[model samples]
Target: MEWYDKKTYIEVYPPKEFSFYECIAFLSRSSQEVLHQIKDGSIYKLLKIEDSLVLCRIRYEENAIKVDFPDRQPEKEGCSLVAKFIWEWFDLEADLKEFYQLASNDGILKGIAKSYSGLRIMCIPDLFEALVWAVLGQQINLTFAYTLKKRFVERFGESLMFAGETYWVFPTYEKIASLQVDDLRELQFTVRKAEYIIGIAEEMVSGNLSKEKLLQKRDFNEVKKSLVSIRGIGDWTANYVMMKCLHDTSSLPIADVGLHNALKNILGLERKPSIEEIKEYAANWSGWEAYATFYLWRSLYDEAI
Candidate 1:
């Protein structure tokens, strides 16, 4: 994870292409975000590690991401897990040189790559969170999606009180596996979304699906097929999960409205571009489709409200 425990806090050194500011900006895009809180250029999040709650204050310091414990620091083992989580969350292992090279030649991405050079594909790290979040966002505006998420988390997720503030972690699959559709519907989640999330949680509880098993498939199509094999998970959901959870660089969610809007802004079009045209413009993105799309999403900071 490229980090070490400095006794007081853990220091994580990310790749040169990573910008803590850019990532924190993305995280802070939603004022309704309950998972993390951004304050004074640092992000505060409550994480569950080895069944314990760890409150972390993450900020950039001397070219490295410093994780300090505002509540309490766990043992060395917990520190390592937090470091690994940070690595995956920021996608530090990814080499963006090739993606930048590809973006330079594409008209749609050329300026974006340069404008947001150090931005990485901030990931969900947890497969269940990624899947359920994608489901919650389906066919909803970004602001409303975040509202649903906040309501869902505040209702079912665990929280820790630290210095007069409550920090939360995403509700575990085990917690949601026992829930019924009506339980989630009370939080304003659609019937289909509630079913989809509960079903996914049940699958996890039954040991039928997992991030490990999905990645074991290796091939992109195989992974997509496995995800789509689950009811309510379609092509867009599969691609979104692959990119955010599995770290699949080639995963492209072409139907994303934010991507279309970014293209409209960059290409100076009066209307949204056709799906076929998006495919053609994105042809060069090939292996870097996920990165390209993420960069485009960043172009519209209000994409998530």
Candidate 2:
């Protein structure tokens, strides 16, 4: 409802405690997506709303974020939707007081949390995009996963040129659902992965799987159960979607390698902890497991955990 003027740029007021640079640091880790850019203390991305694509350039100033559309300004309704998307993408509504206070008491989390203050769990807001990301990252390392995504997006996703740069939008489920395994196999995606991705895309396009439907579940366990029922989606993938897309603060991907490595590095263990050990350690973060996982992952890059 704020910043409704279509003739001018839309401005969003983040929480006073928010840090755009910290969030930019997190986002800048991977530049292969072709959809996002973090440079010169500003963030840029192409967002597809309904049928039209809009390019958004966001810069932080004082206590607010300035959002500008260089090519075309969206209608008031579209502007509102984009504003909400940005808010949710950064988890902007969160008040980290309780999480920070709890972290202060945690031996491992205390230092990591303090070092990465104002770092929220940045999320992939689209359900389809999030699910596809989970499926892509499934048996691969982060670097290879980015390679596959870059190829996939460049090949299938729509693009627009602006100022000698090409910006892309993640391919819609409709486009993916119509493809055969061979179509993706040509792009280096394993046959099994292609099937799994197409299956999930078909589900989303057919009205069977959706963020709105998933959110109807009563609790995290219900959401996890529903997601894991799909092909190629396991407990880890389900928890990932819940935390990153559904905004479940307590979601934990206990089997994530990044999480394991972060824990192993921070705890000074000779080997990665067993699932049982992870469970024991998880008791310290009952209600804030997602934030703990995020900060711990950040430790891998920032080395402050």
Candidate 3:
């Protein structure tokens, strides 16, 4: 991998309340350059995939914002978009004052924010792609999911070379939508995953799954219900995709195995919580269930460390 250095300055349209360091940490979790080592409270490890190591940090001073990615210099046109990406990922502009007030009134929100800082529920704004990835990851180890995604991206995604290295874009629905199930299976996807991806693609291409329309609804539960109505998407997959990709703050994957295990361990329960138990436990989270899940996941890894 090749490495480049760049500095970016962004104007914060609305003043943000979260710590700059926390924002960087949250953004880094979503960056392809950093692999979040959850075994230890979500410490980021720079993976030397090809040859480059990317590290990012942020500095906030009154009206000006400074973002530094030491190892990779961003292309000129991408700078503004990158800044927006970080801001959106951290939800830096969200009105946190209201949430804080609510947290003071509710013990669960206070405990959750104090413990994990609302670091989860960062959505990538690409619902179709996120849904496909979530379905591919179901009931399987994350390593395998990454491997499959890598292959899929390399095969179907467009590539751009910057600073003497190559980066691939996530495959577009139009591209993957054209692929046959056999083509996906050749890339090591299971029959179920292939079918699910194809189904999602068909829906997207046929205009049944409209990202614009989904965002317009603004009701998390309604979007989730719509997603699960698709043939291959279940509860876990729907909630996970909505939380991560749609940035649905209210969505929670109560049936997720990792979440269940993490909650059991953190709350000192004897065994993993059942889906019903998890739902009841998370009820207090209300509008912040996705953040609650993030805290539980952090606690899970932190406990191991």
Candidate 3 lands at a TM-score of 0.75
Per-residue lDDT of model 3, residues 173-194, tens digit only: 8888898999999999988899
Task: Report clash pairs, candidate 2.
Answer: none
User: lDDT tens string, model 1, 116-214?
Assistant: 888899899999999999998899998899999998899989999986899989999999999999999999988889999999999999988999889
lDDT of each: 0.90, 0.87, 0.64
RMSD to truth, every model: 3.2, 3.2, 6.0
Q: Sort all candidates by lDDT, best to worst.
A: 1, 2, 3
Error of 3 at 154 (Å): 1.9
Give candidate 2's whole-model lDDT: 0.87
> In candidate 2, what are the lDDT values of residues 1-305, reduced to their tens digit?
22323357778887765778788889888756576977678787899975899988888886788888876878989999889999989988777888898899988899888888888889999999899899999988888899989889999999878767788999999999999999999888999889999999999988989999999988878888889999999999999998899998899999999999999999999999999999888899888899999999999986631
Query: What TM-score number comes out for model 1?
Result: 0.95
Where does model 2 exceed 4 Å of error?
A: 1-7, 303-305
